[model samples]
Target: MASYELNAFDRRFQSISLVGAIEQVSPYTLNVGYWLRDPNQLILYPDLVASHPRLDFLWEKTCFEIFIGVQGEDYYREINLSPSQAWQAYQFEEYRYPETMPPQVAYDIELNQLKRTHYGLNVSLDLTEFMLAHKLKWSDLFIGLTAVLETSQAQQFYAMQHSGQNADFHNKRDWLHIF
Candidate 1:
């Protein structure tokens, strides 16, 4: 399973992939067997530094709030793992954004401004984890935001669901068998 976190106003986001087994019976859980991507590739942009001087200092120590799980046919579900369980799994981080950067901070203010601009997650997981964990020779993993919902009520409803619970299904009602 993989997990990631991003600030609401902050465009930055990150995800990590893990190779592991799914104990969907007894534990009904997913495990991180190994990490596919190298951690070095993950990089953080300076813009994530909150404008305030005091807040800027906290950037390094700031923990990215994360949600984790595997993506199902129509949605992503949270992986219900205890803290101890996460510690035992193999994990790695990957980063994305800023298609390019300049070598030096000199001359152009515009360039310098762009230098601080960050548009994606601060970290991500190596893709190799997904392939290994799923028992597939190859796979592709994508991370992004959901821009649309079927209904305003549905949108608010799922937002609450996503924020409050960690489960295998996005909509608990969908899983219920009504008599």
Candidate 2:
């Protein structure tokens, strides 16, 4: 597992530190985990009882995101997982450009808020299948991990690397390499 510490696009998150792990659970499964310290410091949306429909913009509020792709590839996949355990996955042919995703694929997410100290979300997906659909599970992969935080006063962005002189997590230069 590769551990990552994210920086806030906005300085307000100075007291908030986001950390997580990304690893291959098996040839077919990819496991990801991200934890938010001090859950009370942000205004998170209410949890949903079931999975959300695909393509919903959960990022508008409080949510966690993962961007994956083969190294040096312009096309990539993005997954959005919310504290409510709802999720959306998309294949981008290019930056902010959507492509047709496979008709069927398995995606899973487990969400939890641990009292007042932290909030954690764990995800397991058939990345191998997704990769196969795209091409192959290349030996070298890159992932851009991010989270959107909402406070009572405003919304903030946090990512592997800050971009756009703003909170633009879509900047490919900010994605982190993973194997």
Candidate 3:
């Protein structure tokens, strides 16, 4: 398992801490967890939907994100998870180009805990089809973990590392976890 303390691009939200952990349960299964420690409930969370539907634009609100990329390759996959039980996944050719391609994988998100001071989520992703489609193996991939925290005031971005002047999560250089 690998643990990372995500850095917020905006220093004003230093009181809030976002931690991410990821592990490979099997050759094709990846488990990820995110814990947000916000004592003041400063972040906005969407109400959970019963269906846990897969939807787009979850990033417009507070949400978690994952980026999967092959070593030394420009093509990548992005997955988004929301507290609202909504999710989205997209395949990008490079640097957010080629808009999106249908993602090939199964995923499950469990709300581990939710409260005024803390929010937690666990995600399990099966990457069998995705790996096959991309001709990739577990050892050939890198993972990027990120999140967007939206409050009434503004939105803050969190990532393992930020390489650009702006919080650009799509930058492959920020994907530091080799899986």
TM-score of 2: 0.81
* Candidate 2 local distance difference test against the native: 0.69
Q: Best TM-score goes to which candidate?
A: 3
Score candidate 3 by TM-score against the native: 0.87
Order of models, best lDDT first: 3, 2, 1
**lDDT value, residue 150 of candidate 2:** 79
Q: Cα RMSD (Å) between model 2 and the true structure?
A: 4.5
Candidate 1's TM-score reads: 0.21
Per-residue CA lDDT of model 2 for 46-65, tens digit only, reads 46645444547678778888
- In terms of TM-score, which candidate is stronger, 1 or 2? 2
Clashing pairs in 3: none
List lDDT for all candidates, in order.
Answer: 0.22, 0.69, 0.80
Please, what is the TM-score per model? 0.21, 0.81, 0.87
| lDDT (tens digit, per residue) of candidate 3 on 152-175 | 678999999998999999898898
